[model samples]
Structure formats: structure tokens, C-alpha cells
Target: MPKTIDDLSTPCLLIEKERLEANCRQMQARARAEGVALRPHTKTHKMLSLAALQKSHGARGITVAKVGEAEVFAAAGFDDICIAYTVVGAEKSARIAALAPGISFCIDSLEGARQASAVFAGLGRTVRVLLEIDAGYGRCGRTWDDPSLVTFARHVADLPGLALGGILTHEGNAYQPHQAATVMAEARDRMLSVAVRLGDAGLATRGRFVISVGSTPSANVFRNAHRDGFSITEIRPGNYVFNDLTQVNLGVCSFKQCALTVLTTVVSQHRGAGGAVRFFLDAGRKVLTSDRAPLSDTYGQLLYHARTMAPHPHARLTNLSEEHGWGAVRGGSTLTVGDRVRIVPNHACVVVNTQDEAYLVDGDEVLNTWRVDARGHVQ
Candidate 1:
């Protein structure tokens, strides 16, 4: 049956099948050329179908943010997974041990290592752990040159039921919306130097150490690092699969490269006394999300139509309430009640979390539906 946005309900998440496939293939190609393994972060889309597609494209594995998410992917046959966030506490530790055979994680301290040791030992399994190094993101991890790094590494290596997988970093600060390339490159360099320094200090054991670093903005940096002999073993970029307004603003991907969008319908229109046109859409902060990048001032960008991803230069998504998205165009819009429009949200990850399923479309034809199966697995 023929299916389009008009034929479906309003405020629905949509994924362009062609663009998403191209994005995956391009990232894989770049990784192959640069000699680094691609283990794309699956926290953005969190669908087993897309995860399978990534694996088919030669990705080494997948990265998730939580143990629950890793369990979701693992149950779906994604054996190799990394919970990039720190793994602590008994509840999450037990969950991690249950899925520990093929899963790994990031840790920054000896205490976290001990926690894993206790739980995994009780469960009779070992867990691979990577040291999280701070590469200027400042969210987590010790600084690259911190004197205590080697001490913590040695402590983690000595712990029972734990294997030092390697080192990794999230250059999350590179999402500056401007100057991202330079910042991303610098973060990669810092992360690479730390890996080299630690390796030289005899931190590598059992086998060749895995030096992984990435974020959507710093994905190219991983390529450049590999080409420059930086010995980076893996890259974990999540947002590259569905470039949103944030990625577009950071210049990581063009609007045409973005694959995910929201299909919204105009519910009402109002005109100000000064001759301004304002329209309310069914999609609001609950649907599109309010995660704006540094400079972009809207929840999402307005696409002219569902068939075309082109944005109306004058149209802007100004405000969003629980159920209403208020937008304005400088001149006027011909849109009236029940008109459909597509919105490229600012953050595809957050938007995906707000939905249960997404329509997979190839051009104007709806091909299938993908469940956000791992959504809300934030534990």
C-alpha cells in the first residue's frame, strides 16, 4: 500500500531509508580508509534493525550509554557492545555481569573497578573495562596527563574478574556549533597522545590495547588520527546515523545528509494585528524536543514538505509547549488547518526517546516501521 505522511498520524518520527544507509556506509568507508574500527554509538536510534545495518557495514560493534540498553541490544544478537558510561552500583553491576560475556564499559576509578570485581566474581564471569580519559570534555574521566592515571590503571589491572580493555574518551565538548572541526581535531590529538603515553608506560597488557575516541563532531578526527599513525583502534559516534539540526549547525553534515525528521500537521493559524503569520503544529517540545545547539534558536527546522527535506528559509520553529509548536514566518505562510510539514529536530537522540516507533520511508513510499526498542533504558 502507498503510504505518506498525510496517510499517517501527525507528530510521527520518520527516517529516510536511503539517507540513513548512505550515512552508515560513508562512516564505514571513512573508517576503512583510516584503519580504525567503527563501533557506532547506538544511543541515538536504539533500534536493532539499524544496529544490524551498522554491523553489516563492518562496524566492530555498538556503543550504548547504560547497562539496560546494552542488555536490550545483546538480547537482539548484538554480542559485542560497550556501555560507554561508567558502571557502578550493585543493581547495574549485576545487570552488567549478566551481559558481561560480550559487553565492556568505561571506568575512571579503582572503586568502580572493585565494584565490577565483586559483582562479576559473584556471577562467575569477567568484565572488560576501559579507562575513561578526559579529552577536554570535562564531563568525566581524569585528565589525560593526570599523574594518578597510571596508578588507577594499575589498580584496575590488578583487580580480579576485571580485564583492562583499553582506554576511551568522549570529546563531547566539540559540539560547539561553530569551530567544531578544530576543537574536534584537538580533542582527538589529546586523546591519541594519552593513549600513546600510557602505552609507552607499559599500561598495555594481555594484547594490543584498544584506544577508542569519538563523538559525532570528532568522527573525522578519528579518521585523521588513523591516517597520521595515531594508533586509535575504534570510533564511537552516535549522531552520525541521523544528523540533526545540531550536527548541521556544527557543519558535520549538511541538511541533505540528515535522515530523521518529524512529520507534524498544522492545527491552527493566527495572524497578528501587525500582519504576521503564526501557526501551531501538533508536534511540540514533547515530540521534537527542546535540545537546541549553541547558536540555533529553535527546537527544529521546518521542512517545506514531507517529499522534500528543503527548509523554508523564512519559517522558524520559535516556541514549543506540551502539545503545540508555535512557528512564525517573517512574511506569511499559505498553510492552513490540517496542512502537513516535516521538521528536522535539533537532537535526534532525544526525539527518538520520546517515541515508540519510527516510519522508515524511501522517498515518498513508507517501507516499514522500526521500534525504538531500547528507548528509556536509562538505568
Candidate 2:
């Protein structure tokens, strides 16, 4: 039998069901108002039930960062999927071709496009592909204005077993600024400009130009971007489903809306010189990923007091090692060992990647246990 939320072990990840559904509805309505299809990236939750909630709210499809993730979602009955990463390698190509019958993938290189075409040809299937453009992220995508972009698109179109779906880009660089509104505006403009330029070159035909842009920061600012000129058929935003401390710090979301949290138990408490107090939690880098990006400084944030549901205004996580998180409480609040607390992780995606399953919670009640189906599919 599954354990209830209150009876479950400490230092477990929990998702507030109501908050998650609310966030989904908000994103879905925003995308609908902009007349763009909401194809949320499933890399955030990686749960079949959550993906179904997204689809139920009128999402066009789900987006994934890896072929393995796509396979996971496809097996869960999510047929229409977009592999947002650059398709490469003979092994990966074969896997992609195998999925082509049920899913679509993004291609950023001529070699990858050709390989996909050749592989799909043997199966008598034409794989649908999206040309990934470099929207100043300097990541895996090709330069949007590069003259070779047109040639590559033409090459993919000419391939017998390949269908050019459109262009895609991840405006991940926007997150660097740490300002949600500014990053969002910049992302939308950068992505839309690339789409317009491609359309002007006659590369977009029969309205097949699908301008897809994603990144949690970018999605937050999408409302400001002009919607008419660009053929932005889809908007893929995944992190909105489970807002984390990073999103909260970036101003993308508030603390109340954060649906996912790591519940931990206080293992130790001590008083230091000058009457300062320190508290330690059993949850550490092993459970909460230590992979901090450039702008982030800490592993996670403390959610005030988990027991009383009281907001901790000045509480902060001081340090973290392999298996311990040292917290310093500013105010004179008595904390004892065995006290339970909730931590807002710095990066929810990384936290999810580290766990095999998460608890579905409703105000102290554990409703169900959902597997992190796509966890550890790093390849």
C-alpha cells in the first residue's frame, strides 16, 4: 500500500495538486489568448498524469529535450511529441526514426537531417523535423541569419523521407538577466525576428512555418511580443508547471504559487557565539542537485516553517554539502531536532531528475505517488 503524505518518510519531494492545476490553467489560457498552441515541455514534471492535465487544458503537444524523454512520454500515450534538442548520431538517428511514426523531432544540422531522411526512408516513413535556429543562445542551434540556414532547410525539404515542419529555438540566454519581464520580452522578439526573416526569404511555404520558442523566462514575457508577423504556431514552456526558487528569485512567480517542494526533517540544532542559532536538515546536495548555474548561488531555499505553514521572511539556506543543508534562522524562533520543514529547490528540473518518484499532496494528505518516468535518461 502507498503511504499517505503525513505518514511518508521525511525529505521527500511533494507536489501540491491544486496549485499545479492552477498553474497549468493560467499558462493554457495565456497561450490561447495569444493564438499560439501550447506545447509545454514535459522535461519539468516527467509524469504521465501531469502531461495529461496539460493536454486536457488544450495543449497541442508535449516537448522534450532528449530522445529518451520522448520515448517515455510516447509510451505513456502522448503520441504527438517534439524532441526539442538537436538530433545527432547513428544510434540516436535510428531511435528517432523508430519514433518518427509517432513523434516529431527537431534538426539543426545538414548531416542530422540527411541521416534522419536516410533512416526513415528504409522504414518507408518521412520524419517531421523542425529547423532549430540560434536565437543568440550560442547553444546547439544554428545561426538564424546564417546563409546556410536556407540551404539546410531546402536540403531537409528535398530529402525523400523528411518533412520540414518549421523552426525552433530555446531562448535560454534570457534567464541570465535574472529579470523575468526583461528576459521574456527579449526572448520573444529574438525568436519572432528569426521567424520573420525566414518567412521573408520564401523559406516558409504553404503556411508550414512553425515558429516555436520556449524557456520559462521567455514564456513569462511572450505577451509583449508582436503576434501577427511571425508564424509562431506553438509556444513551449515547461517550468511553469512547477515554479521553483529560481523562478521566484527571477520574479517569474511568487512563493505561494510554487507547487513543488522538498520536505525535510531537522536533524540538528545548535547555538553559536553571540547567541546565533543554526539548524541542519537531513536533505542535502544528493537529494537536491548541487548543479548551480552561473546566476544562482545556493542549492535551495527554506520555505519558512513547514509545520505551522508560516512564511519565513528572513530564513535562508546558509550552506550545503554532500548530505546536509546548514540553515541559519535570523529571528528568535526555537527549532528542535526532528522538526519537519519544506525546501524550495533552486532548480525544480534538476531536483526532479534526481528522484525516481514524487508524492502528490493536498494540504497534508498524500493522494498518490507519481513516478519520475523520464528521470536519468541523460543521453
Candidate 3:
């Protein structure tokens, strides 16, 4: 076993194994109690081992954002996978076809459906697809109440080598600056109304139709939505496995539930002309990331130490350069040049993608090292 954080290099990513497992259990239990399937999004961790752990905790399947990411997980033996983004182009569709027979993906427009259908047809297989409904998040997908939805459904039904499996949506607006419960309710009601409307169109009578909705901030609303008997088939939350400062700010999770942090060391310290102490860390926009939570302007929060994973509160990450983070000491924090600190980034998903590997830790003891095999698979 690796000894301590000293054995690892500076600015390394660390995953608190116990906290991660606990997070998985909590999400799984919540989904089960509400009688909904948890098909967690794997784009957060991008690690096969952790995805397997989620499966072990009763996830129905895994969700990825790209065909490249799906290939990585499928090669690692994850059979049921859903690409939650719109897939277009011949090359991407071909790559997606190779992973077929157990793959499903999202379709937001008729042209995408035609392209996917044509490509999969040439490969001699039918591809299952879920129509993406824009439930007022306004990012991607056709509007839920669009009169053209039935026309698109009819077109998809008549297309060769393309099967309309169900409807899917992401209530991403929940991450916006709003009361967590309020956004949750809006997300639940909007998506449920659309799902019910679509299900009544005779498509759901085929037994393959499903209504899926997810986003970590609105996960509880999904549970309550399901408990309210709206026939929500699956919940696809990704970041619940590693809560971040954003989730903490949204009240989706507490700091104790966050499972990942940047193990950074203080490399330099100096006082301004006004006699205020400022320290720079080895972690910066490259690792800790500059994703600011709407609730806080700080890039990240510095942890007290290994004995206490609690945020120091006094040491605020005020600014970030390419390879350095400037932290300000307030409330009488006496940080020194050689002090070691853990930083809980504003967003964990993008932070994990910045590194090639992460150290799995249980307290200060390094349990093992896992490669972030899909780090740059953004294509």
C-alpha cells in the first residue's frame, strides 16, 4: 500500500473510496425506495471500476455522453449503455454501430434520426433511440409540447433500422441559481407532463417505451416524481457519485459527501503591500478547474488537513492562473509555504478529466492507483 499523500506527486487527483461507496449506496437506495431504476451517467468519473461498483449497487445501466466514452465502458464489459447526447455524422454513427446489440442513444431531430438509421442500416442492425424532449431546460431536444412531436414519432416509427425506445430529458436548469427544491419541482412536473403525453400516443403500449430524467441536483425530485406515480422508468444522475462544491451549494449534498479533491501543496507564500497573506498552490485551472459555483465566487475551498476533511473556510481560493492557484488567508488562518492542503473543486466532473490518473484513498493511506482511461475522449 502507498504510505501517504507524500508518496504521490503534487496536484494529483484523489478519490475518497469510502465516501464514494457511500455515495453510490445512498443514490441506489433512494432510487430503489422510489421504485425507479438508477442508470447513472458515467461521464463524471470515467472509470470502469467505479462504474462497476455502481452496477453492484443496483444501477440498471450506465449513461455516457459520447460514442467514444461508450466504447471505453463497453470494452470494459458494461453491456447496457446509453449515449445521452445527440449522435450525428457517418464516422460517429459507425463507431456507435460497432458497440450495438446492447446500445441505445438519444435523438433530438429528424435529420439525426435519418442519419443514424441510414448508418445502422448499412451495418445490418437496428439501433434503439430515445427522443430527447426539451423540458424547459432549453439546451437540446425538441420542446415537450411541440405539436411536431407526434409527427417526429411517426417518422421514427416508419424509419428502417431505427427503433423509438422512449423519451429522455435532462433537467439541467436545476443547476441554475434557484432554490434547490423549487427547481426540483419544476423539473419533475415538466418532465412528467411530457412523459405522460408521449406515453399516451400508443408508443408506450409496446412495453419498450420508457420515461427517463436525471441530473444530480434534481435527483431527489426524480425520486419524489416517481413516488408520485408518474411512471418514470429510469434516473440517470452522474455527479452524485462524487459531489462537488456546486452540489454542496445547491444543498444536493454536504461537504462530507464529496468524494474527490485535488491534493495540492502550498508552493509559495507572500504578503501584499497591505500586509495580507496570500499563498499559491500547484493546482490551477489545469487541475482544480475554474468552474465557479453560482453560490460562491471562489475557485475552490481548501480543506483543513487529512484528519479533518472539513473546509478550512478561512483559506479561500480567490484566483487561478494556468498552473497556480492564489489563496487568501482570512479569519486568522496561518497557512505557511510548505503546508499541504486538499482542494474541493467547484465542479468534480471536469476536475477529474484534467488528470491522467487518480489515487484511491481511505484516509491518508493510498489504496491503489486507477488510470483515467477516457480522460480526453471528448470526441
**Backbone clash numbers for all candidates listed:** 0, 0, 0
Which runs of model 2 end up more than 4 angstroms from their true locations?
A: 1-4, 178-186, 200-202, 224-229, 272-275, 292-298
Candidate RMSDs in order: 2.0, 2.4, 1.9
TM-score attained by model 3:
0.95
TM-score of each: 0.95, 0.92, 0.95
Q: How well is each residue in 126-234 modelled by candidate 2, as lDDT tens digits? A: 8878888877778888886776766677777889788877888887776775555565566567666766666666766534677888887778767744544654678
All models: lDDT? 0.84, 0.79, 0.84
User: TM-score of model 2 relative to the true fold?
Assistant: 0.92
Q: What is the lDDT of candidate 1?
A: 0.84
280-317, model 3: which lDDT tens digit per residue? 99998999877898789799878897557988867788
Ranking by TM-score: 3, 1, 2
Candidate 1 C-alpha lDDT tens digits along 263-370: 989999988667798999999989987778657888788988767779878888889999999989877897888888899999999999999999999877888889
